[model samples]
Target: MIPIHENLKGKVAVITGGSGVLCSQMAIELARQGANIAILNRDAKKGRDVIERIQTSGGTGISVKADVLDKSSMEKAREEILETFGQVDFLINGAGGNHPDAVTNTETYQDEATGKSFFHLDENGFSKVFATNFTGSFISSQVFGKDLLQAKAPSILNISSMSAYVPMTKVPAYSAAKSSINNFTMWMAVHFAETGLRVNAIAPGFFLTTQNRNLLVNDDGSYTVRSNKIINGTPMKRFGKPEDLLGTMLWLLDASYSGFVTGITVPVDGGFMAYSGV
Candidate 1:
């Protein structure tokens, strides 16, 4: 069972990409804590499904059609959320993913590699990945900043990745974008420090999500080479479950638990960040 934070009761939480594997779990858990959830996704149906689950569990929430990359879209979402919830207490920037075109088929550079290489990476695809991951978060924050600042105890939680710390192979665009998220989190935290708007991030380790499932799993249902390497590197010797992120997320979002904490990215990696591959 997930722990409940009393401070979250009756507050409002806005989660971007709330229909995704990880963020969906966060939306449900926050709802369980009595927070009114606003789930934003480009796919309205998927967002509504999450809301249905929340409602079935006796929680309050709404699904909003939004594109994190578009400021106007986020603005509309924010307006709807405010209309329903009256205020915004938390913002979770959870909308980010990698495109196949932005990735290199080979781990390292190769002069004669037949597959797509770094030199052949599609500029449009790379730009889309970077914009979706980094620019989306930036836009969402801007659209919601005023409402968050007005709250008595507001916070912003960004979803980062383990790649942000150590750039992973084959996905340079994803790595660079996540790294920017870490820096942006710190920058926003300091910018709003005196305003009581805390900004933090959760850098999740290797979790199997739609975005990385292809890279981590094979058609035969066995772990891919990359997945095995990840497990070996993780001190816990396993890929993280979605629930693994809940505790840290709650701790960071709850002012009673982490009021003084800001401008930091907490890694929920099951010791992945600590292991040195000795």
Candidate 2:
């Protein structure tokens, strides 16, 4: 809304999965920093809403319907961004999710003798989870990174998860995919270091959102066993808010602040990764 050129105004930022909860917040915050946010998401209406909010706040943004798994779709979106802003300065590869199929029925449910829960972990589901989260982010990096070479300074931020550090049980696919993202962030950072692009990642702890609301709280506003365990394990003793990540996001995106930083996967958890749960 206010004049932005002082800090990060006039920069172009692309956020995949921008329609989702966390990325949507980043889009808004980045816009507030004077960036032209290009929101790319498969969901048309949700992306539109994020754009609308950015516009309402007097920040600039545009919504692009895209599938992170599809290269052509990402290139088209990149073309659209070039048409709108001429260059991309920041890229947030935020498209990812867990599939019900990739998770076992319970954390310690290894009763293959009964074969009850093992049957639930379908191969098709595992494929979907891997495709969407891991493969999609990888493809998006390639597509948008083409422009980074020409820009003065460009940045790539990937979304990882707490699962990457410690497997929480059940969601083996999610853990694997996030771990890949973590590793890829470092690899890409080095691979592109000479090209003026800084690649980094954020591994968030449990954040209550529409995606994981059922797992955290009940309809009556009570915490579940899973949620309690998470709280107890975390030294901070609670789940994270989406806004809790904005500080880290801002620090990483601004070149003036973290110019020398790259290949780092900063954990924005509530000390969850640090605590041994003693």
TM-score of each: 0.99, 0.94
Q: lDDT tens string, model 2, 1-278?
A: 22233457788899999988899998998888888999998887899999999999899999999998889988998899899999988889899887666767667756554532756788988888878888998898889878877776789999999998877777887888888899999999999988879999999998987767877798899999888988998898778988888889888878878889999999999888788767
Candidate 2 segments exceeding 4 Å error: 1-5, 110-116
Give the per-residue lDDT digits (tens) of candidate 1, residues 194-217.
Answer: 999999999999999998999999
Report the Cα lDDT for candidate 2: 0.86
Clashing pairs in 2: none
RMSD of each: 0.7, 2.2
Question: For residue 213, what is the lDDT in candidate 2?
Answer: 80
lDDT of each: 0.95, 0.86
lDDT (C-alpha) at residue 74 in model 1 = 87
What TM-score quantifies how close candidate 2 is to the native fold?
0.94
